[model samples]
Target: MNSDKVLDARGLACPMPIVKTKKAINELETGQVLEVHATDKGAKADLAAWSRSGGHELLESAEENDVFKFWIKKG
Candidate 1:
């Protein structure tokens, strides 16, 4: 994951988290990985849905210390 880009969205809410993820992904080349971190509870589902709808790959998701981390690979 060293080659992946990380977007820290912790403290952001709702659409902002997903929106930032989308923006970051747009800057990445296809097949590149994006690591997103957010504190919003909605992040898990929102990111998953966004990845699915956009045809991207959700590589991993986990919660730790109230923070959500999403690893996505751009399609």
Candidate 2:
């Protein structure tokens, strides 16, 4: 997925990825996408829930080489 900005949250733990994603998404305009790279296994569920509650759209997510990637569209 194409993203307006990419956030490298690899190696970070729990709320850190969500926290950084929140801060990064806040800088984007509505409809823009933010691509996040993370190593935290829990981020998959955490971000999905955060996106819903925060009003952002979690377009898609995937994992490669143990890294989880998520594409989120700002709402």
Candidate 3:
């Protein structure tokens, strides 16, 4: 899917990815998609939980090499 915005949170740890993702997602209108690239292993679980709690849809996620990519649709 196409993303409206892209957030690169690679090399960050813990809540940084979540924090940046939140900020970036807020900049988009409803129904828009945000693609986030993060290297933190914990970002998977963190973003998943954050998305659910924030009422956003976690459309897709995948791991390539050491990077994690997430496609989230704003709700």
Candidate 4:
């Protein structure tokens, strides 16, 4: 999905990445996608949980090399 905003959370740890993502998502409109890139291993689970709690949609998640990418759609 084409993202409306890109959040570079690479090298950030747990909670930080998820926190930043939540902030970004809050600024987006419904149906807009936010792309988050992070190196933290906890980002995958943390982001997923955050998305669920916020009623957002996790469109896709993948890892490339050591970086993790999450495509989240704002509700």
Q: Which candidate is the best by lDDT?
A: 2
Q: Which residue segments of model 1 deviate by more than 4 Å?
A: 1-3
lDDT by residue (1-75, candidate 2, tens digit) is 788999999999998999999999999999999999999999999999999999999999999999999999999
Model 1 lDDT per residue over 1-75, tens place: 443799999999898999899999999999999999999998898899999999999999888999998899999
TM-score of model 1 vs. true structure = 0.95
Residue-wise lDDT of candidate 3 within 8-75, one digit each (tens)? 99999988999999999999999999999999999999899999999999999999999999999999
RMSD of each: 1.0, 0.5, 0.6, 0.7
Candidate 1 root-mean-square deviation in Å: 1.0
Using all chains and alpha carbons, the TM-scores for the candidates as numbered come to 0.95, 0.98, 0.97, 0.95
lDDT of 4 by residue, 1-75 (tens): 689999999988888998899889889999999999999998889889888998999999999999999999999
Q: Is candidate 1 or 3 superior in lDDT?
A: 3
- Residue 11 of model 4 has an lDDT of 88
Q: In model 3, which regions exceed 4 Å deviation?
A: none
lDDT of 4: 0.92
lDDT of each: 0.92, 0.97, 0.95, 0.92
Off by over 4 Å in 2: none
lDDT of 4 at 41: 94
